[model samples]
Target: MSSQPTSNAPVLHVQGLGFGFPGHSLFQDWSADFPAGLSLIQGGDGTGKTSLLRLFAGETAPQAGSVTLLGMDAVRQPAEYRAQVFWRDPRAPWPDTLTPLTWVEQLPAHHPRWSGEAWRAHVAGFGLAMHLHKPMYQLSSGSQRKVLLAAALASGAVLTLLDEPLAALDKPSISYLLQALEAEARASRWPGRAVLVAHYDALGDLPWCARIAL
Candidate 1:
């Protein structure tokens, strides 16, 4: 993993965050500061790990408090904030008719750091190159997840939030992701980049910069 010295400055800062649905509450007065590198968000079902990630990604606004990334208020400057983040809900609805290649081709416009070459490499690493031409509906769950994973890794966003990333992935793909993330953590250009992944199960034997449980 990354042997580079980590800075104390928080790449992502959350203050008195709160969120809830009709009758269920997720977080209340929750606060934390995430430094650069990989951070695992561990929790059981209903613990709101996913909710917290969504909040950080600007996909869902907090009911109270605020989220700051690189000194920018997520709520006040959502477009700018989101531009620096890469998040894709695994269960998010997709255009069933679109191929993976088509979907990935549009990512560069949204992610300035996007690398088409990196995307292709990740696709090959995940054994997804062969499936890129197939429609989303025709691909298996594992393949679909790989497509998204490839995009996330290639986007090179300052902050990347991935929920249930290991789910539906094969052993080889999982290993590839782990190794890729480790390399990302070590990169000099991505010094302030932070990757947050939510996992329900133990991240046993996996290299992580840190872990936080909800």
Candidate 2:
């Protein structure tokens, strides 16, 4: 809805964040600012890329420090803060047995900026027309991930977090996703939205707003 020129200010701000599993520490005194537009969180396996995204999404609270989005405090105003963020872990199992169409239909209530037009466009672009009616568990791996990928693009949440976006995607689907990200980089798509992708490598020569090497 907002077509204003992108500001250099951080859409997502983090400070003094810390986290770790039982035996290993992932982050200590980690701090970073993520501006709106396409950005990459690049690292190899076991580098905590996904965990970092979880922290940004507020799904996994940091052991210390703070996170804020668009000046919305993720700690004190969690519901409001998280509503503006769109994040889904592709590695986890989905307990929702609904069809992709049904699942996406619920986005508007949770995501104030959810865009139906963008959803329709991405669904078509990803060639997920037929799979829309099928239960997510019934779809192929590629199709299942495509459903989530399309939702991530169309959710219109202030911050969209994508982990390993290229996984399970076919060649054509990958091409479509690349085009979408390129458009975002050009300021021609998903305006006013900050998207962070956690992956091992850059997908293309995108003019990323930020590049954090986890």
For candidate 1, lDDT tens digit of each residue in 1-214?
1122247778888999989999998889999888888888999989998889999999899999999888778899898888889998888878878999888888899887788888888988999878989999888889999999889988878889988888999999999988887777777665678888899975665566778898
- Model 1, position 127: C-alpha lDDT score: 94
Candidate 2 ranges with C-alpha deviation above 4 Å: 1-6, 188-191
- Counted clashes in each candidate structure: 0, 0
Candidate 1: deviation at residue 5, Å?
A: 14
Worst 10 residues of 1 by lDDT: 1-10
What would the per-residue lDDT of candidate 2 be over residues 1-214, giving only the tens digit for each residue? 2233347778888999989999999999999988878889999999999989998898988899999887877788888888788998887776567899788988899887788988899999999998888878888888988999999888877899999999999999999999988876676445568899999997778789889997
Q: What is the lDDT of candidate 2?
A: 0.85
**Residue 186 in candidate 1, Cα distance off native in Å:** 2.1
RMSD for all candidates, in order, please. Answer: 3.6, 2.3
lDDT of 1: 0.85
Q: List the residue pairs that clash in candidate 1.
A: none
Q: Judging by TM-score against the true structure, name the best candidate.
A: 2
Cα deviation in Å at residue 178, candidate 2? 0.4
